[model samples]
Target: MDNIYIYMLIALAFLAVADLVVGVSNDAVNFLNSAIGSKAISFKTIMIVASLGVALGALSSSGMMEVARKGIFNPGEFMFDEIMIIFTAVMITDILLLDFFNTLGLPTSTTVSIVFELLGASVCIAILKISADDSQSLLHLGEYINNSKALEIILGILLSVVIAFSIGAIIQFFARLLLSFNFQNKPSWYGAIFSGIAVSSILYFILVKGVKNATFMPDTLKDLVSSSPFQVIGVSFLLFTVISYLIIKFTKNNIYTIIIIIGTFALAVAFAGNDLVNFIGVPIAAFNSYEAWSASGVLPSNYAMVALNQPVGTKPILLLIAGLIMVLTLWFSSKAKAVVKTSVDLSRQDNVKERFEPNFLSRSIVRLSMTASEKFNSLLTPGSKRFIDKQFAKPVQALKTKSEDMPAFDLVRAAVNLMVASILISLATSMKLPLSTTYVTFMVAMGTSLADRAWGSESAVYRVAGVLNVIGGWFFTALSAFVAAAIMAIVLYYGRVYALTGLLILAIVLLIKNYLSHKKQSREQKEADSLERSESSSTQGVIIESAKNISNVVKRGNKIYSSAINGLATQDLKALKKNKKNITKLSNEIDDLRDNIFYFIKNLEEPSLAASNFYINILSFLQDMAQSLDYISSVSYKHIHNNHKKLKFTQIKELQEIDAVMETLFGDIKSAFASNSFTEIGTILAEKKSIINLVTEKIQKQVERTRSEESSPKNTTLYFSMLLETKDLLNATMNLLEEYHSAHDEKVAPARLPGSADPSLEEE
Candidate 1:
């Protein structure tokens, strides 16, 4: 009997672990995007910060446990087993549902999922309990419905969207205003420090304190650390202040960025700790009850079992175990993301030639949600759209633009957001409505996005309006959870329900799929590496020969330079035009080349300076080719207009021929990019450079000849026009080319690739 109880405890512990892991993995995405998009930190650093946040959040979660215990359903209405089953159902459903959304990169509310799942399970259990025991028949369904916490949760969920969106926009607005004032000069360290402290302090106070059951400081910790709220705040503020100061002085990092990252992590962790109980508390409670009963040697009586409160000492232990499990789950979740990326790439393969498609389930859901939103909109007041357009739509659109680049918070916007959030949350708490923080935050982001005109053009206003239209779909999360829980409860009551059996089946399926995917990826990567090595080896000799030829050409060009220059010039122009169409086609090619180069270089058994040098030379050659293209475009326009006064038709023909050579040079450059042939790129670029210099010299000579002749007004006007066009084209070309080059560089650079072997790639 003792051993059985102990085993049950262990099982409960493991379940807690599973709950924590799933909780963190699912919630991590909510804050992940903001940090990454803001360039606040590297993805790896963000994850690490999030992990620590989860740990601290978990440790301080006891206060929220009270809400988990009594906030949802009346415990007296159902027996111990029934309550346990409801909790288990909620946990399993919530985990799966949240993870599915995370995998899709869509941020949904965990609070909404829990509330709905709990409602569903509780409703089912109540119905079953009532039916089995006839004495409870007088307790009407209306009574149960009225007494239910569903209303509060629903209201909370809905109102949170308005609150968060408004706040985010307002805050971002003021932030931008303050930032703009220092346009010519960057903010000083003192400014950053002050701003960081102010924002962090405000966030900690409002979000941490105002959220009723937020777990940043558990009751136990408050008691242990200090007796008064003021004391606790003072201590925490001082500690954080010192830490921020040290980080700023030593690391020379942006304090605002750091504060945001930290704040995000803190929010994430608090979310996990508080919400974990919503997901798994009932299950743990039931398990504990079962263990208590088994220990007392009780057999079958009613389905109702003994109720057990979690031992105070055991709560911390349970939380720690859960936190660790959550970290592991987060790791698995990352692996899943990689798989999704690969799958996307595979679907886009040239051989497959299929239009990439989302799964049927996703498409169906989106369509249904859209239809529902349209119907709901039509039923509203005739002036509702106009009201939304004027009050929410216009301001939100304007605010969106101002919010870009992590704009400082505006007091007006913040006040508006706060008022909306406070009023909505207060109303929901009073009426017992369920609302979503994700919905609130996301909509506020959109509203601000709209208010600021972040989308750049008014055309996007409708699209954003359409996106805001979808916030209505979040209600479906609660609805679905409710339905799923009801169905699950029916199965538990009537069918042969084996909780462990269901869990084991799911675990097995996920494990097998994960293993197979990993194996396949490894095999594909090896094959790719092999192909790259073979290609590199074959191209090495050709590259060396071209390099030698270029060297000889350069050396012999001192005497009779025109002939050598013209020959090289002709070849370069012809290549450029042929490859212009193919430049955009090299995205995949560059990605593959980057992967191969990093793999080969990193795995070298001996010092391979030649190989390293070869890669560098190739990069240099590509750069030179880009410069040559710029020079050619500048010189070729004079011929296009026939504006050179002293030049003959023969010279014009020669210049046109040079344009042809420039076109050829661009064509080869495009092909090299498309094929991922870094080895050949250098040779092609060298030829391009030789051609550019030849064209430049010819243009310079024409300019001198024209200057020595009469400067006609028509000729001068033509020259100026040509010069303006040349400058415009050069600027446009450089901008486009620079973007392409930067993207390509990131792809090829070993350090830039996510999860690559190179340590530099590992750094942000």
Candidate 2:
């Protein structure tokens, strides 16, 4: 029994390492997004700079580990056994929750997760203790828990979102107006002033947020800061501003580059300084509790954890090791890039396609914003409106090198993003208020994107949706963190040994699964792009490219459909999930092909723009086929995942038959497209119709069975939906075959040739 506490202390130390890796992966987006987005520095250089900041920040951290000790609950009220259980549960929950968010590439507040987790796990135990003791009433829960402190943290996090967004928007708008998009031609003074302000903010951030918590800071200096905060900040600002102005005059340098590098370092420092508690705080707290118990020379359940309420110093060496782990994760973790990409895609200035689909809420918000803009413009005088519009206009051409590799925003905005975010967060830190760095930095970047008009009409809805999705995830983090911690705490309390073993095993499994999944996805992405670009310089080339794409669709579609059927019949969700992933990659490829229509058209000969039109039609059908397969495979996986009733045996047999017919039809379609002959188009079309009829019959039988024999609504829906989606999938394949046949036979009259002659005007 005594050995359990020792085992738990060991577990806490181990979980801390895992937590640091996952926590840094999620939080990397906050500091790295701006640097990565701007491409101001080389990838290696940016990483090295950020890594150093994390290491330094970790060393300087105030060791907010006290928060885990007693910030959420009254640690003095609990025995060593209970405190160990609660702390252990927190370590498990924090690592799992952070890792889950990282795997999904969403940036959530580690502050929120850890705080709510402590609150939750503590609250659960408090309830149990009250229930077991007649003297302790539910009304006296506050004596055991620190609900007030937890509420304050929650409210502070919520407040920072609105504040960060508003401040970011206003400052960014003026910054852009002062230094327009094409500010390179502007006077040097304009750039200097921008650099001055940016550098000043970051300087303030470092002093206020980054260093105040340094474990090595002398007591006298801490007292001096406490005594005259304003005087200290003023001196720092003056020095940074002077340096900024001197750099402007002394060198023909890119001052924006200087600002970005400095700002990146500051934010990284702030992250490690302030956010370290979210990772190793609980483990350190548990270690402290263990030490206290050992010194007491009492039984585990007899000793109280009263010392937890007092602040304890964290070992600088331990901080250094945690910092090293974070730095390594930054340099090596593949998921860091994924998280960074999500931020960049949302805030990028180019016309690249959006990753998130727009919903009604996003569309409505965009529409309302457009309406307000129109009304505001109407109120302005013509001259004033024209002046404002010009400031916001995108330049006719941007400076160029590798546009593909260029940052989402320029150095100016990147510097502003890093500087302003650091200032805001540092101020909060100085005031002893809890400001979520992730929430602040992410919102500030978004706010600046809005001001720069990166969220134009073409992408506003998607950008808004992306922002909303991330914000929603933050709230989910709080909820999930709390509930999961509470549950784990209860399990640890009653089923101590078995629960610990089960949870540790579960955490290891999930981490391995996500790691392998992420790696496989990376490989798949490379393979998808490595396939030859379907170039179309001439009508012949166009036909050949179309055949290749068509062949791919046919081949992939058959496999996807077959995989869904077999997996469903066997209840193998893993196979079904893999198939769903394949379908998604295929759909993304078609979307890329569609997005390239302009370039494909530009490459065509004057008389061969007709090839563009043909290529467009071919891609359209292929996209539809891909989508149908996506729906089928995804729904099948969901049904099986929910443990829904399996389809009747007869229904499975029917699906097997339909899968065979679809396979044959896909083969025929592939041969016709490969030969560009479509001599077998009639045969393929006939086979498609036959397969559709076969599925329709199955669907009808299911309907009848539902009315008389079948009772499960989910089972009915699952079977019917697959059959219907399969029908659509078949029709799409046949349509592409017909489209190819038409493209192959058309011959426009040369006497009055246009770039694109309609098929109706072509000679027979």
Candidate with best lDDT: 2
Give candidates' CA RMSD values in order: 19.2, 7.0
Residue by residue across 111-220, what tens digits does model 2's lDDT show?
A: 89999889889989989989999987899899988877888888898899888988888888898888877777677778767776787778767877887767567888
Q: lDDT per residue, candidate 1, 582-658, as tens digits?
A: 22222233333333454345433345555554554443343333333334333433333343444344454554565
How close is every model to the real structure, measured as TM-score? 0.52, 0.81
TM-score of 1: 0.52
Task: Please give the distance, in angstroms, between residue 171's alpha carbon in candidate 2 and its true position after superposition.
Answer: 0.9
Model 2 ranges with Cα > 4 A deviation: 215-242, 245-251, 398-406, 529-551, 558-585, 595-611, 624-764
What is the model-wide C-alpha lDDT for candidate 2? 0.82
Question: Which 10-residue span in candidate 2 carries the lowest summed lDDT?
Answer: 748-757
- List clash counts for every candidate, in order: 76, 0
lDDT of 1 at 189: 45
